[model samples]
Target: MTSNLTDNTLDLDQAITSIKIWDQIRDAAQKSLRSEPVLEKMAHHIVLSSKDMAQGLGRLLSHQQPDTLVSREELEELFSFVAERAPQIITFAAADLEAVCERDPAATDFFVPFLYFKGFHAIQMHRFAYWLWQNGRQDMALFLQNRSSVLYGVDIHPAAKLGKRIVFDHATGIVIGETAVVEDDVSLFHGVTLGGTGKERKDRHPKVRQGAMVGAGSILLGNIEIGHHARVAAGSVVLKDVRAHATAAGSPAKEVRG
Candidate 1:
């Protein structure tokens, strides 16, 4: 009986550790409230009073919807429905928060990204939009895209498939085309455009592979692949494929490192 109890306790601890993100957010929220009691009302609305990550995300994302289009309650209901139907959205959101906290120096904990970071919010909205796009609700997906752009200055097409643990640092003016694919653990900076060279209706956008990092204002065009672990220099115009573990720079980006 004693051994069984001990094993059960250990299992429970491991389970909690696996999803320690929500736990960390709650703890950070409490700490923030203590540090600045004046922010109690605002904090409670999104984080402190929320039951879990999903609920908190619903509050934060729904609040971004313009009042002229959708009411707060309606957007919250939609967000909750999407989260329920595809629970992995929440999983991806948690991974995203983890990435921001681990990669962004400004983000010391989950609470900051959960409540204030537009990049984080934009990514969550993109995930929700991706779900809508996958479900054949393209109209709704576009609506969410518009909301994200107007609110965060990030324009990510609904059809763009994004993997987990991705970070969009200072994501303002970032544009991703319909067929673009961003793989896991990738990081993108502000003003980056993953667009096509011409009016090709087919798969013309870039495919950014896992662990690659794109600098700010970089433009990667065409049906090219940004190889795994590749790095694009800031303000470069990439017209060709960047090989794996390589660094590309210059106006028309050329391989500078391998």
Candidate 2:
């Protein structure tokens, strides 16, 4: 028994070192199949049979679209295009997955969020659509945005720049406008809007710097900045720049004691 346990530990370590996140997620899905017999077919279809992380994510997101707007085959083709052209997205997705696991207490395993979390799904779709926008496919990008909003209730413009390790908790009603920029390690809760207060077209959106947390129902409007490591309290309406590492709250949010 001791020898068997030692061998298993070594094998597990080897697997972790050799395989990528996709493989880790697949292994988790397979294990879940045994424990969750009802999800066997879903797991097989979504994760087990997929060739790679990109393919699996593509299939999963595409499956959510209405058949009237875009067929699964067409969306899969677009997803493949983005995956092939911009491989860095896979890295971003891996980082985002790690972020969700680390930041969300409810997350137990990789497969849990990959299969069920709308936030993760919404962000991945935004990444793909962003790629499309960068490649001069504006209409297609907008189409994807529309579908994603309809499916997940998260509306993020493809042109909005988002960094890795972003946690969108309870992603519903989250709106990010076209000129918005959210840096790395940022956490946005439900009903958070990085939007414009007026109709001005040029750069009319908020810039959320690294390590910031925008609480639920908080609105950061116009060309203001939420500095690094800052925290905006829930339901606050921020109209101006927030200093780094500060905590801001209330309507037309003001920095309070940290």
Candidate 3:
């Protein structure tokens, strides 16, 4: 039997009927169905059979989640519920796919991230978990958070705030603490950490502003601000605020070029 989308999803389906991204994915799926016989069944099940972007994405992500704890059908239902309620997630998810294709040279098209990239998968999972966390469904949210960590090797707290067009390049070993706030257009490389420094409870994580780029293996501790367009060099341990357009490096990261 087929699943049914809620009113909002149906409305959103109509709203995005002409959006190019959906057309791109559908076209790509059709091509893969014709060219790659091995993936034809999978592609048809995930993309061709679906009516819209949200439903297709929900099925795709849900296909990756769950290892006997929950069925794919159950996760798909939960994801559908999240999208119906928080339609901005659909917008952010589309922006995320665009960001990867635009920023990562290795990513060639929407089809790549939509089908294979773990970073893209992990981020969408967090968006759903974050929504659950916000709407008083913390237990289920944390369950999804754990699934994301185990599946993708990227751990972002359900309470951590994220923004649009965020790119996590080679995102393995990334950790975002409970209070961390990563703003729009931010790019974080593999092994990057937005972590707490000490024992004190409130607002302990770093706030990465819009257009900031944190390099691979870098760690930003405490509640410091990494300003707009700022750059944190690879392997640095930032302990202070980095002003806009500055580049921070070294163990106790200092502003090298402002």
Candidate 4:
């Protein structure tokens, strides 16, 4: 009886066609984004990320998924997830940019990418790896992290906890150490190092609290908290806690302003 029924009317191809499956799926995704402001914003980020990944993959392989490979349905799903997490990512990205502006007046010109320019395949991968690390999938996170660094020349450790609105301007030679904590609204300039003091076992890296900006070529080492709204001057080596709204300069940074 079962074989007879299957032979009589089981048509998987036709069933998919009858539903207008792909078309309906695409339309539904678009509808959800259009209906919700939050979803729409998230969709923008997701689309950017997807495009970046597609471009990166194309560069790494001889055979590549066409730039147009991202279907509307897939893009919608990506945006939906981004919408749910937009508050966090947006906050971090902002903090990062604010930090850059504090360090250099001209920083805005370069840091603009994190705000509007999308094509940072490496940045998207870093975000994904960081998410994996938070979920306790360290191996996969590390694998992605290494891959991103090898391909893009940017090495941000997955274990680093970054707050919302973080910016990495002119993003070359930037190294974010493990155990480093970047709070909201932080911006890091090129050649910035949030590093440790010679492999010390205990929390041996800088903690950039909210609204902190580390200038270009700065080396902030050891376990120290850069207080809220603090600025680490260019080429400085910071080794101590900087009070909130203060500015630090020189090696073993000294408080310059408040």
Candidate 5:
């Protein structure tokens, strides 16, 4: 009985040491992944934004000094969330940017500027505003909304629903209307307006289909449906439904190609 007890104690000690070693390895990997060079290098500003937002919340809550590290499982869930609903934002910022740079020089020209954009500066700000909005701080949310516009030139209403992987490449002059539904893999170029056609009070503005690319300087007004895999050509003002796998171009845009 004495020998058995000694062996059990030794086993417990070994188990604890093994667990500690695994923990150190896990911490090192997560630290590497969460670094700016790793996370932000791919234009993964959204992931970086979420982490910053979480850190800000941690600070606001007075959780701990330097904040507690998020678990690997939790981090994976966040990345998967971005992958499922608004994948383009993550894909563009993460892997697509590199691929695009090699394939399309124009894409490189457009995306590089947004890498250092002040637009995403409000991502954490919006998180706070969103919390306020949820907690009946409508006025506070609106105030932050105004500040976001003034600072970022990217006006996303405090009440708007934004999914992951939604990239606002060159984010300038981009407006996300109050009732717009932007799905995953939706990519918006510079100066694109997703807005209401008139003074309609309901679900006005546009619904961007998944994997759809809205070209630069395009206006998608009213409750228009931009279909999946559809490309709204540059300078087009689309007021009507664009069919999937089609290209809409020209003023009062017409489908010129599929």
Candidate 6:
């Protein structure tokens, strides 16, 4: 019984530590809503009334629809389905929100990214779409991808694998291919493309390892690997593997001494 109590305490501590930032964000949102009467309806619907992060995010994403192809009800149902089916979606979102607050100087609070940042919105939408893809709902995934591209100007393939703590700064015009894999703590700026050289399919996109920083307007082609902690300079065209901790620049990017 003593051992069970200790284990329970440790589990509770771990869970609280994991959601520390999320709790902070929720508290901040509530305070802000209280002070700003204009935001009462929107804030209450998106955050205050929400039971948890999953429900809050579901409502937020579902409300972004323009009522064309998918109605607000349909969008909400889809988001709720994904959130319930895969709880990891909320986990990734929390990490992502924390990442934006830590990495972007412009981000003042979690509510900023949760409400206004299209880059953050695009990534979360992709998470839902990716869940659909994994569950053999490819058509629905494609539909969400198309909607995300139209709304956010960021086109990430539904099948692409993404890790935690990724910051897509100014995510407009960012395109990631179907087979591309982005590891944790990676930062990508606007106009970055992880693409293939030719029409050949089958494992043809770039693999970006952990802690890499990809600059704006850069194009990385083929099945090349960008090693961990490497930096690719802006407007560079990379065609080869970049060694870990190295800096690659210029067209057909070559390693520059870091």
Task: Name model 5 segments beyond 4 Å from true.
Answer: 1-53, 56-115, 122-131
lDDT of each: 0.85, 0.85, 0.86, 0.58, 0.56, 0.84
TM-score of 5: 0.58
Per-candidate TM-scores read: 0.91, 0.91, 0.92, 0.59, 0.58, 0.90
Best-performing candidate as measured by lDDT: 3
Better of 2 and 3 by TM-score: 3
Query: Where is model 6 more than 4 Å wrong at Cα?
Result: 1-19, 34-36
lDDT of 5 by residue, 204-233 (tens): 979888778899999999988899879999
Model 4's TM-score against the true structure: 0.59
Residues 1-258, candidate 1: write the lDDT tens digits.
Answer: 001110112234433442678878878878888999998887788877777788889998987666775798998888898877776667777878888988999998888888888888998898888888888899989999999999999999998878878899989999999999898889999999999999677999999999999999999999999999999999999999999999999999999989
lDDT score, candidate 6, position 216? 99
As for lDDT, the candidate ahead, 3 or 6, is 3
lDDT of 5: 0.56
Candidate 1 collision pairs:
none
Q: What's the lDDT for residue 162 in model 2? A: 87
- By TM-score, who's the top model here? 3
lDDT per residue for candidate 6 within 152-219, as digits (tens), equals 99999999988867899999999999999888889999999999999668999999999899999999
The parts of candidate 2 lying over 4 Å away from their true place are: 1-19
Candidate 3 runs further than 4 Å off: 1-18
Q: What is the Å distance of residue 140 in model 4 from its true position?
A: 1.6
In model 1, state the lDDT of residue 180: 92
Model 3: per-residue Cα lDDT over 1-258, one tens digit each: 111111234336524632568779889988887888899878988888988888988999888865486999999999999988977787777878888989998887788788888988888899989889988999998998999999999999998989878899989999999999998889999999999998759999999998899999999999999999999999999999999999999998898899
Tens digits of per-residue lDDT, candidate 4, 1-258, equal: 001110223345533442342233234445657776675654444332333322212222211112345444443344334324422332233333344445545544322332233223344455556756776779866866775566556788987776545666666778888888877667777788889989599688888988788899999888889998899998999888999999999997999999
lDDT per residue (tens digit) for residues 9-55 in model 2: 23343334324778889989989988999988878887899888878
- lDDT score of residue 250 within candidate 4: 96
**Backbone clash numbers for all candidates listed:** 0, 0, 0, 16, 9, 0
